[model samples]
Target chain A: MYGTNPFRELEALRREVDRLFEGVASPSKLRSAFLPGRSARSYPLINIQESGDDLTVEALAPGVDPASLEVAIEGGSLVIAGEKPRPAQNVSPEAWHRSERAAGRFLRKIKLSVPVDEENVTADYRNGVLTVKLQKADAAKPRRIAVNVA
Target chain B: MAENTVQKTNGSTAVVATETEATREPERFVTPPVDIYETAEGLTVVADLPGADPSAVDVNVEDSVLTLKAVVPEADESEAAYVEFRLASYFRQFTLGEKIDQERINAEYKNGVLTLLLPFAEKAKPRRITVKAA
Candidate 1:
């Protein structure tokens, strides 16, 4: 669902275009960002949203062990690390009908556009998604300023 | 015995399978990632669907077709200054295999992931027969 905010939609659209061109921009360098297949670093697909004074970072990853899930906010960079166990570990090699979902340990570090207060960060895991909220470190200054001639 | 072809919806690897029934729904849906494997007892399917209220998730089988649908609530992305992933309901379907026991199928949802157990019918289960030497 989209909101009435036109600026945000334009920003989202721009990001989408940039992401699509990434494959051609650097064929060998760009790995999958969200969905994992032959994924090396970009494991969980992430979406960052700025709502009011807080920045919410959402990672769409399911089946990750709650105990193994970890979120660390270091200044403007966020770290998400976790391990997803295989569903049927004991099953023989020949028993698999389909193994489309990815499994194993994953760690992703995202450089945020705005500075955030690490102390005010909160993380929650639900329905296989991880959402982290961080308060902006500095209040955005008002645009207009009066000039005085001495 | 012939086995049903398991067509996969792969948005990750980009080996997209042409789907007819999946796009029939007017509402937008995401094909949640899934892992399916078979053991001696039956088959186990694990799927990832974030933001789905456990009560709103639906799993059903009809006419030998297994469908998994979950109603997901939009997160903070509605008016976000920046966005990467958008929230959407989950929709995926699988045709039941000949060996599956339609009567005893089981389903469970936890932490936005759904696990389905499709046990093989008793007669279709693997069995060993003793040999007699005269």
Candidate 2:
């Protein structure tokens, strides 16, 4: 089953702290930056790395089902959309004090500066992290030249 | 029935009927125990908040939206880290359906649990009427 690790949990906490500080650091700039009608969603923290022949992007999305997620590369943008339904209510009458859990629809888009081979794109969801591997197109691959007149 | 207790870190606690084995297995961050019941007067929601203080909890309902926020007192920032199990502090929000009564919701915090009573509008709750023989 999909799950989250302590490191990922810590990263989530760090991201929240970063967001809080970002909003608090500059009251004026923040107001102008976060105008009404603007997107209130935060993009998932993705770890991108390049290997020999492919680029990988890993997104942390805990408690979200892989089947419910929609990942696509459209016109140089990677879009991930999904919704996490709220847990069923089971509260009793005599209970006191409650803590709210975060649950709702979420969408995240990432722009890829470099063109990748869409046909060979592969994705996997494991341990609450979605990893996408984009292979470079044939033309984009580096050519090996032979030593000639030297 | 006897009460079954699960000892969670950060002073968090969970209790259920001894017959319920769902609470037994190794604790994962699974769903916590809570229940919602509807009555003629309104909707009453009971939540388990172990080790939670009344002064530290906040509950509000507005325009069919219920928000619950609380702080689980942690050691001072300077205090040495002993061991951490679950995330500190708690936050939960629900955009209630139309059946919820926004103006007259009641809440109580005790025994480390939070109970919220959301009274629905007069016409919002279901009503059964007896029809005379035609």
Candidate 3:
């Protein structure tokens, strides 16, 4: 079972009363109005996994060439930067109701708990997928110990 | 075992070929591929949407829910291609927890990648504490 927030619930009752009393009460809009060139921060999407001795970080960067991408590790943070080129289409030069596609520069920064071996890190790009494998530090690896019962 | 023979003549290069299974067909429903990563701040999600411009992409958050929508333009009618792996786009959404700061969420699209920055709410972030002796 779910319950409504008491604050919002009270506000709703107030709005109902205002609507009943006021001759021209306007309902609050639910959707935000579209804005052009709004300030926004850039973040790159990534997939991370820990294998036996490696922490793999994969960032989906299709339409970008590996040569143009730069990957680096500073302190405990991994950074990936690259730019994507737009593709040419053969569509007619006419008006369209909607156009939605994103293209441009992208930068991603990730902090790792376990230190990574920068020298041994490897990155590969194939079929528009970029895969980066970082080898974990020796101290971060798990060790097992046998317990002796007295 | 099948061993095929190849012969070259007249300074012509002979082509050797071996047949293999056809590639997997594209998914019936167009679904974009997404990459998600957890960061110290919060989480980041990247989606692949070729031929999709920023205007065509839509991001919405309502009542702690995040949604992404886009459309993949259809292929040219005149051109013929041997193979294609692209697909259409629709909408994808995620229900977030208190960890996400909805007000500070931001996104950007460039090329074919859509990147979302989800910052963790200050109250929901993890903090380390020192041990005290009694």
Q: Which candidate ranks first by lDDT, i.e. highest?
A: 1
Candidate 3 C-alpha error for residue B60, in Å: 32
What TM-score goes with each of the models? 0.75, 0.38, 0.40
Model 2 TM-score is 0.38
Ranked by lDDT, the better of candidates 1 and 2 is: 1
Docking class of 1: acceptable
- Candidate 3: misplaced stretches above 4 Å? A1-42, A89-98, B1-134
Ordered from best to worst DockQ, the candidate numbers read: 1, 2, 3
Please report, as a residue range, the 10-residue window in candidate 2 chain B with the lowest summed lDDT.
B79-88
Worst 10-residue lDDT window, candidate 2 chain A: A29-38
- List the TM values for chain B, per candidate: 0.81, 0.60, 0.69
**DockQ, candidate 1, vs. native dimer:** 0.46
DockQ-based class of model 2: incorrect
Q: Model 1, B1-134: lDDT tens per residue? A: 12245543221111112244525577666677677776667778888777788988999888777888997765654657655566777887776766778889899988767999888789877679989998
Candidate 1 off by > 4 Å: A1-34, A39-41, A138-150, B1-19, B74-78
Instruction: State the lDDT of candidate 1 residue by residue for A1-150, as single tens digits.
Output: 997999999999999999998746542231133257455546787777776677888887888899999899865689999998878768776556566677889898999887777788899998788989888776542245789999
Pick the DockQ winner.
1
Q: Candidate 2, residues A38-148: lDDT per residue as tens digits?
A: 335363445566655677776645445456888899998878887644433454433323323344677888877567888888887653456688886677776789989
Give the distance in Å from residue A94's predicted Cα in candidate 3 to where it truly belongs: 4.0
Ranked by TM-score, the better of candidates 1 and 3 is 1
Report the lDDT of model 1 for residue A13: 99
Looking at model 1, residue A42 earns an lDDT score of 64
RMSD of 3: 28.5
